[model samples]
Target: MTDSGIPVVFIHGLWLHASSWAPWLELFRENGYQPLAPGWPGIPDTVELARADPESIADKGIDDVTRHYAAVIDTLPRKPIIIGHSFGGMIAEKLLGENEGVAAIAIDAAQIKGVLPVPLSSLRATLPVFKNPANRHRAVSLTAEEFRYSFGNAVSPEESDELHRQWTIPAPGKPLFEAATANFSPHSPAAVHTENEERGPLLLIMGGQDHTVPEVITKSTLKQYRGSSAVTDLVEFPDRGHSLTVDSGWRAVADACLDWLRKQNL
Candidate 1:
């Protein structure tokens, strides 16, 4: 495939290893884009190592992960198109706001500072981290049952278990803690530059059945960018859950993204 000279950066959210983006990277490359999926700071290169030494990623917060990706962008040949999921999605928005990317796609991103709706399911989904305040400074691993609830709820139990076995890893709790308290904090790392009118285009993708980040959260996120004249769009997958990006139907989601990028001429 001839190189398009366009870079696509994939950012994974909590509990999923960066390698989970393998399929997307291959697909994007075949379509002429240079795609890279980098692990979060302190993250091991592989899922096994990341699971074995969760402590290496403990205590890392949103700002830490954001800064890490920002540094990664600095090394790229050109400003990449940032595509992120969960917390990674929020980080992508922050990066785009700072003029780090040519555009961004935030898929089921975590809530930022201005979002106020906290759905009960969202609370239950994150109960693993919130149940113990100490988790804020530790790395927390989810059991298969918990993963089923949080990330695989909309998928078949069998497929859910398989996804858990393949990609689930311990994730830092600090980012969740920071997001939970963002609205109350004057200096929350969860804050994004939604007011930046000069930033590049942004697309917010939501999994309608997502227990972790419901559609309401994504809609609220869109509202935050209303004051800015920058291009911001929203798309929802009503039948999908948090696992949509890695599940069987992921190709559809990825195709939608590619279609959108083409529309933007990027």
Candidate 2:
């Protein structure tokens, strides 16, 4: 943000802790950037703690979650560049809108929910949890099989299974409910109130094979923000899925952002 040091932050999606961003944080550090990855409210910092009890904080909402990260960003030495995946991507976009210094990259992001283009894949990906109204106050864990279909579709079965074992934690259902039931109103929980021109160089990346946040969502979001003067770029990776940031070929995506950073002279 100040151009005084490396500026990069990684935000993980639902069912994942900040540690999931560790791989990318290391990559960014190697490329001469400072990295910050923080977790949501009441979320344990370690995977062991998260696995030990998934129901501890199953009712957290988007605003509460956003405020937690807002506090984290407040402590930063400067307005760090942000990179987020899935739900985290949504929060990053909100942060970009709220803070003038935020530069952002959203990967496989799901915008508020009522953007008029719900691809069948996107619906199917979220169906496991959203099919029931009771999920709102509960925590949802991905079955190995379900995780494979929604997230690991980009990789091998074995690799996907292992990543599933290592990364996912139970996620609060309230955020999804709010996103799904965003009320089609300008004043809503899912409303990010973003100004495309106010955001710094931003990028939105999508997975070609992703079911959770399909390519159409990225395209539509770009179209909505096309009027902004800020640089906005959309990129799609062949066969990638919602778990693009955590999978084996994640480096390519991260490197792409790094290349974009060079182009922006950030």
Candidate 3:
């Protein structure tokens, strides 16, 4: 079957290898869209290799990652529908606001500059990296227990361990540092053009139980887009956590996305 000519790009957040989007790619492809999942700059092609050489992905900040994905979008035949998780979701919003994508779905996205509420759970979820300032220029890996707390808390212990073993990878700490200090910086990379009225539609999905980016943060992110006249919507999965994109219930989230795209006639 021929593709619908519309592209769908999946952006995986930190701690998970880009291959985590494999199922999403297949699903979107079967639904008539051309889908691609590209890794961050310097990310190895495999989880094992990425785990082995964390330095390759170290020290990459938000701007660096955003530019990398923007370059990928430039290579596509049409402006793609961007779907991103965690920091990738932040990148998706930035890209969409800049007109790089036709539309975007930001699921459990990191807090942008204007987002003021930093829940205690969020602080705890990121403590592994924030505990040490020097980590900003390094790569950080989460232990299985930490992964369970931050990404898999809403799922079973066995499934969390399996997910940690299957897709976990060291992630750059620079972006976290940048996002943490966004409000203090005069020109922060974590700042999104939420007021871009000419930008494409946006969807913000929140995992109500997400420790890393709690529900309040997503709600704050929604408020950030209030100045814009563009399409902006929010959905909450109250029982889900940060692992929603790769968990057993991922299909439900993907199907919701597909339904939204169809509604937009994308």
Q: Quote the positional error of residue 224 for candidate 2 in Å.
A: 1.8
Cα displacement (angstroms), candidate 2, residue 25, comes to 0.9
Which parts of model 3 have CA positions greater than 4 angstroms off?
1-4
- Candidate 2 C-alpha lDDT tens digits along 1-266: 35556667677888777798888888888888888787778888898898788787588888887888888777778888888899888887777877634588889877763466878887777777898888898888888898988898888999999998898898888988888777565566677655556667778898899978888888877776656677778888977888888888988998998888888787
TM-score (C-alpha) between model 1 and the true structure = 0.98
What's the residue-level lDDT of 145 in candidate 2? 92
Tens-digit lDDT track of model 1 for 51-71: 999999999999999999999
Off by over 4 Å in 2: 1-4
Error of 2 at 230 (Å): 1.9
Once fitted onto the true fold, the runs of candidate 1 whose alpha carbons sit more than 4 angstroms away are 1-4
Worst 10 residues of 1 by lDDT: 1-10
Task: Write down the lDDT of every candidate, Cα atoms only.
Answer: 0.95, 0.80, 0.95
